[model samples]
Each structure stands twice: as structure tokens, then as C-alpha cells.
Target: MIQSFRNEKYDHKVEILTPISGQDHTYALLATYEGLAEMELQNKKMFEDEEYKELITEFFLQNIVQGSMTTQLFRTMTGLKKETNSQK
Candidate 1:
């Protein structure tokens, strides 16, 4: 669940497919760090001060959504095939 611009700019909610393995703390932390780095790279124009940028990264790093893409894709593909065969 993401709330942007005080719930006014983007109030829409999206359904996400989440996998099980990334729920572990190690992967979650690594993913969050990677995401923060990417954000810093992209939002370099918006934030000029290093300290403020570090604060933003700290907040995001504290909260990260963890998931495994491989597991979710495998489940979706296998489920689709199973359903198709059952229909036939």
C-alpha cells in the first residue's frame, strides 16, 4: 500500500503478486538498499542536499516489501496450464 502526496495525487491501489522467499530479512534489506540507490539515482534533481537524501533513503530502507519473482512466475505458469488441461 503506497500513499502519495497526502492521498490526493495518487490514491489508486494496485494488486501485487508476492512470492514467499523474499519475506526473509536478509533479502528484504538487500532489496530495500538496492531500491533506495535506484531512487537516489533517479531523483537526483529533486533533492540536492546530501543529508536530506540520506534521510529519505533511511525511511525507505526501514520499510521494504519483500517477494520472490521466480516463485510467483512459476506458480502463475503452472496454475494456468493446470486450469487449461482441466478444461479440455
Candidate 2:
């Protein structure tokens, strides 16, 4: 599934993370975009792709637990200044 998403050639970053302490059986798939607009554009393209559709129907639907999936979006806080070591 991770490879499939990478093959789509979208202009974003993707990563899969496994828990170190909590949630032993759970994994997180993270996709980062420049902003909301780029996220929307890439999502539209992803859903429209035939390969992605096939993956969802043939693989994701069968293996993943029903009602166990969730989607969340987060954005970095704006106007935050990076504190240099010297400033501390």
C-alpha cells in the first residue's frame, strides 16, 4: 500500500510510522503537503487514479478492519519564531 501511494508521483511527502511504546499493533501513514489547497488537489488526483481505486477495492477493503480507520489533518502553527541555541 505504501509503495502504491509512492508510485502515484504526487507532489507530497509520505511516510509510515510504527509505535515505539503505545498502540503496539497500530501504524500511522502520514502524508504532508504544503497547505490545504495542495492537499485537496493531490487527494482529488489520488481518488481519480485507477490504480488507487483498485487498491482500495481489492486490498484495503479486505485486509483492513472495518470502522477502524480514521483520518486526521494537522497544520503547523504560523508566526512562531525558531529559538536558537544562543538565545536560550
Candidate 3:
């Protein structure tokens, strides 16, 4: 499933995270977009993809817990620049 997302070449970053300490049974798929517009566009593209739809129907819908998914969005604070190696 992770590979499917990467292969699609969407204009966003995707990461898969597993807990080191808490919630051992939980895994997370983190997708970072430039903004809400990008998120919506990418999501639409993803949903419209036939491969994605097949995977969701064949795998995710069967294995994942019903209603267990949750979504949260966060924005970086304005004026905060990402720290680079050169600035360290």
C-alpha cells in the first residue's frame, strides 16, 4: 500500500510510521501537502485511481477496523523556517 502511494507520483510527501512505545497495534500513514488545496487535489486523484480503489476494496476494507480511522490536520506556525544543517 505504501508503495502504491509512492508510485502514483502525487505532489505531496507520504510516510508510514509505527509506534516505538505506545499504541503498538497502531500504524500511521502521514501525508504532508503544501496546503489544503493540494491535499484536496491529491486526495481526489488518489480516490479516482483504479489501482487505489482496487487495493482499498481488496485489502484495506477487509483488514482495517471499521470506524477506527481518524484524521487530523496541522499547520506549521507562520515565520518558522525549517532548520537546515548549515544553520546548526
**Which model scores highest in lDDT?**
2
Candidate 2 lDDT at 3 equals: 51
Q: List the residue pairs that clash in candidate 1.
A: none
Alpha carbon lDDT of residue 9, candidate 3?
65
> When superposed on Cα atoms, how far off is each prediction in RMSD?
10.0, 3.5, 5.4
- What is the Cα root-mean-square deviation between model 2 and the actual structure? 3.5
Q: Which of the two candidates, 1 or 2, achieves a greater TM-score against the reference?
A: 2
Tens-digit lDDT track of model 3 for 1-88: 6555644667888887899998888988888788999899988987998977787677776768889888888887889888999999
Tell me how candidate 3 scores on lDDT. 0.80
Q: Against the correct fold, how does model 2 do in TM-score?
A: 0.77
Point to the candidate with the largest TM-score. Answer: 2
TM-score of each: 0.23, 0.77, 0.76
Against the hidden true structure, what lDDT does model 1 obtain? 0.38
Q: Model 1 over residues 1-88: C-alpha lDDT tens digits?
A: 2222212322222233345776534322111113445445534633665655665567667764444223211111234444566687
| Candidate 1 TM-score, true structure as reference | 0.23
| Of 1 and 3, the candidate ranking higher by TM-score | 3
